[model samples]
Target: FIVGTITSGYYSINSYDYLHKLWLRQLIITSFHHALGFLPSYNILSSFILRWLGAHIEDNVKLAEFQQILRFPSNLLNIEHGVTTFGRASLTSFTMTKEGLCYVDEIYLGSDTNLGNGCTIMPGTTLPSKIIVGSLTLVTQKYASAQSNCVLLGIPAREMPFVIPDDTSVINDLSSLNSSSIYSLLFVCLSFFISKYLFIALYLSSPVAVALFIHAILFCAIYQYSILITKRRSHFTYSEVITHQQYFLFKLMSEFSTFIGPYLSGTQLLPFLFRMLGAQIGSDVILPDIRCITDPHLVNIGDYVRLNMGAYIQAHTFEQRILKLAPITVNHRSVLMSNTLILPGATLQGQNHILPWTLVMKDDQLPPNTKWSGVPAKQVP
Candidate 1:
């Protein structure tokens, strides 16, 4: 009996030690990911850091600033050379089902693959080489057999009719900006430091509510000042090269707003803050998440419009390695449901109801008082 008890105690100690090590590793990885989001450039830094954290990221891979690997064993993640991600791609390596069964698996991205903004790459998924995944796509293991050089779109990300060209234009464009991007990186870091300093100073000297309000106002003022210095413009064509200070500052403001959004959301302060950032937000507009508006300066929201959580209004897109920008208009009394993506130049005429997870394509003009649904958003009764 004494021997059995001793053996049981030894096994328990080993189990505890194993769990403690795992917890510490996960904490370190999470901290790094959070810090990486604030960095202006993530290509080289992200690849190096992720590799150090046990991810198998290959050479010349370009990861977005906000890309994250959720719930690691990050060692299971493997990316081939020349993989690029445009915006935030969530690579989830772990999942639990309703039956309480937990699973962890590998996620593989082949060479020359491009992931669009807000896409989620699920565990056990294997993307082939030269694939272009559309924005907000959910890529699962079911599509593992998909062919290379094809476009994947929609919720489960099935193959589309488009084929990607075998050219180095995107890589070339990205390479050309590396040297020029250093200035933008420095500017972003300086801005972030100043903003944090301002917030800290105010917080230490005043009441919590007052301090937050003053910090937000000051931050917005600084953003506007930078915009003015950069000669803020409303439109940009696809042919234009956008390695400018203004673009970096724009991204900084977007990230800042998103960071503070949860604190100010569902309050009048949210719209007020967005107004200070140059958005034309109207009275009684309900913005549940400020992250919804990617480009506040180019978005015009009308009265009584309700934008649900995860409703993203993207005012820009990249085509053929070029940037294009346009304004988005959400007219009065319109309702956009959760997880809907409104693309550049989309006009939701007054009194429209857009359902959850719908994608309003670029330059679409939805008629008044209509109910829309689907990936490309056609009117549904």
Candidate 2:
């Protein structure tokens, strides 16, 4: 009877092949995202529960119950006194094997930091006081800091130099300037102006010339944004509004602006685009010329930074059916090595050095001039 029932259900599902299959895929992704979300949320909830009851927690931190642990059946995750772990946050210790698989590892949390839901703190990471991290960040490093105030985000984290004012309770408008205003407008105009010039050159030249010119422009923009010093944190302008030429010239430039610059520049462009659309960025600092997959307006990059090659600076991560995006800021003079991953809604404080090929666990802090290395990146003397 059970087999007959199961067969009937299977047939019923198969009856609506295309639509049902799409629905099933969506459902599976959604379920996975929720399951993943539980890891951080569970640990944070545990920490909150103890805090509300006037108890302090310390040690054996595990984000979820279904996750495996040898020594203890229930993961004894704890948040030390005076330390705050926000709800819907997760700590991860999963590593990819040579065979292309992931295995879970242990995770720990330190002092004070405000973590939003769907945040991922990878294995071997530690968070210190006076920090705020946005949602859905993937941190994969052993990060630590004695710095009182810090902000971080990214798969492999980069530290921004600036911190939000403690007295400031909220950021109602993203355009609120932590730095300056005039500089911001200049860079934006400069970026647009450059794109416009390139558009004209390509217009006069052949299609091949257009492609080459775009490549040149993209490279120049990437180098400038990645390594130069500007007042604005992110320099993203919409090509659609920059030119009204309905012909192929405008379209070509728009494609280059939208696709080429972001992907080649090494910074995630979508986040900057969103931020710009919302008018959240009000500073004058500019990032080194880098190629972003999307536009800078979608993401939030911090002031004065160098984002090296192969680094994934994404402002948002797509999980399940939900799109959780955050602004990423690499604060003034902070250095991220090659191939590092910077996730959404993270700020890397200025003058911090992220060693090459290191993973920056989400929202973790590293003190200025501190040398760090390792898989879950750690401080080197």
Per lDDT, the best of the predicted structures is 1
**Model 1, span 1-381: residue lDDT tens:** 101101101122235432443345456556677665665443355666577657788776766653465344556778998787776667764455565444557788998788877788877888888787888888887776656888888888888776555553445334544563565467667877765665567679999878667757766876776645224554443224344455455554554465566888878878888898899988998888667676678889999999888788888776434456789999999999988889989999999999998889889999999999876688999
Tens digits of per-residue lDDT, candidate 2, 1-381, equal 101101101122224532243234345435565343232222333433333433335432222232221111113233443333333355542444565444333344454455543456654455665465544455564566566466665545556565565543321121333232244345444655666676567657768756655555654354334323222443322222122232223323454555455553434343343243332432443333343222243444455555555454556442211234455656656767765555555556667777765655546566676766654567788
Give the lDDT of residue 240 in candidate 1: 45
RMSD of each: 7.0, 16.6
Best by TM-score: 1
lDDT of 2: 0.44
Candidate 2 differs from the real structure by a C-alpha RMSD in angstroms, to one decimal, of 16.6
